[model samples]
Target: MVENLTEEILEMLGNESRRRILNLLSKKPCYVSEISYSLKMAPKVVLDHLDKLEKLGIVSSYEEGRRRYYSINRNLRVEISITPHRFIASTVSETPELEIDEFIKNMENLLKTPAGSLREIYKALQEFEEVERQFSEILGAVSLKFNEMFERFLTEIEKEVEDELERLVLLGITKGADTPFKISEEYGISYMGVIKALKSLENRNIVEKLENEDVWRIKC
Candidate 1:
């Protein structure tokens, strides 16, 4: 829905004649005869088109001195998206104070939305920031809890594993060195030393060597 014929109606701009007539009215309010003449459309056709547009409530008419003038009524925006798996159409009425938060905001900040001169990106970022700021204490508590738990878990693992080399190899794998060669490079251990440590871990059921892959992972 458009509140202003002067403002852009976007995806709702239906046909060529309506577009031309609207394009004319956007510059200034126009009577029906002036619109028909300017657009080179017949007066009856113009009347029919205006009637439909008026019913949509985006165009409104007022009378003055034997002439009725028409202008855009309101501001509205519509968006449509199409893909092989999805089709979505959405409308947004003018909202000077709309707000948003949650997971969608974070994902949009990471991927979907790009910043430009548009107010949408800027407003979205501000809303996201405000949400994060409000939850800062909760976020800090979660981070600290994870750090404390991981440190305690590592300490227990260290007590269970006797050989220092086995411990180092386990730590390397846990940190993303899934292959023997990567473990050797990351821990600065000799390749044979890394292999020997891996064999000991496998025998103790502490880790497993993957079938058909030169990678390793914790047994569980």
Candidate 2:
């Protein structure tokens, strides 16, 4: 039985920079300077990108004198996942409890059968003991994608808020004891701007009101 290799490989490959490097290497082998020139990036930047791809075993390199040449390792097999930046290894094995070997072999053989048997094929898959493992893997993949998406979204939101706050301070609205609405009014800002800033502060848990409870303040 083949063990699942896709999940681990895909997780590592999901980095945009790394994926770009991999795609470049797949076409043909190139040295670092050649890659940097092709990608229109600095050699150090290319090295960082290659470091990640190499760690995932997607790319390999060998020294040619003082320089190294890298190439895509074609032997690596990946099972692409439906979700973005995710994949499962083609050689996934079922849990020990499942009678998987023969069942998988049968499915592979029957895959070419007529479309009329699709329902029966799905039913058979459901009945297979290894189906549990497949579902678990799917869930794991979903969770990973969600985490990555959430992280990127959070970073973008943080950057936007920081820029907004700088703008607000320039307009003299970073004063103490002013409610967000009051600050917005004083700075001639729209209510939406105030709301967004307040929300950002709340997310960072940095918003604090004075002892009077009516005065809005943010911790430095």
Candidate 3:
């Protein structure tokens, strides 16, 4: 997987346009027109570079009708300087086939709640770190008392963090920008759930939401 990623990275960097395309996309997601305008290049030229980057998995694009938006592959770390280097990313094979009994046991563990040892449970949950990473920061962005008060609510914050996790995943907003009110309406999550999630995240020092407004920010 590392070898494949290295090959892809090298292939991606071989073209100047592709490198520029990554530079434009890294700031935020953008459509072809946006990239072309930003780089002062033609749309067709941007599209060509986008295709090459996407093919190498250095970038991923989503299309909405006649328009396509491109972003750097969140999973593929790209570092640009006088020379560019993209981290070799591992490929995930088909979800490792697990026996029915094993799958059921895994589900049972996930369902077990606060009863199990948190350290072990969290270790198993490491796979989800990237997705949940922002919540920690959100809790930190709030108030001090709110942060301390909330952490004590659960036996182990990790075991009960799921509802908040699902909410954030569904909210579809980048971290530290969107407010709780906006997220609740967009994700169909309750006002209470947002509060509770923020509280839980605060307890863990994962994020902080300002007292005056629901704007959330992740802790550094």
Q: Best candidate per TM-score, number?
A: 1
Write model 1 residue lDDT over 20-92, tens digit each, in one string: 8878888999999999888889999999888878987878999999999999886765544343222344556
* Best by the lDDT measure: 1
Clashing pairs in 2: 6-88, 6-89
lDDT of 2 by residue, 157-212 (tens): 46655666633622233333167667766677776876676666656665555675
What C-alpha lDDT do the candidate models reach, one value each? 0.78, 0.63, 0.61
TM-score of each: 0.43, 0.35, 0.33
TM-score of 1: 0.43
Give the per-residue Cα lDDT of candidate 3 at 123.
60
Q: By the TM-score metric, which is better: model 1 or model 2? A: 1
Better of 2 and 3 by TM-score: 2
Worst 10 residues of 1 by lDDT: 1-10
Q: Give the range where candidate 2 is weakest over 10 consecutive residues by summed lDDT.
A: 168-177
Q: Is candidate 1 or candidate 3 better by lDDT?
A: 1
lDDT of 3 by residue, 21-47 (tens): 777777898998888888899999888
Q: TM-score ranking from best to worst?
A: 1, 2, 3
Candidate 3 residues lying further than 4 Å off, grouped into runs, are 64-66, 77-220
RMSD, every candidate, angstroms? 18.6, 15.8, 21.0
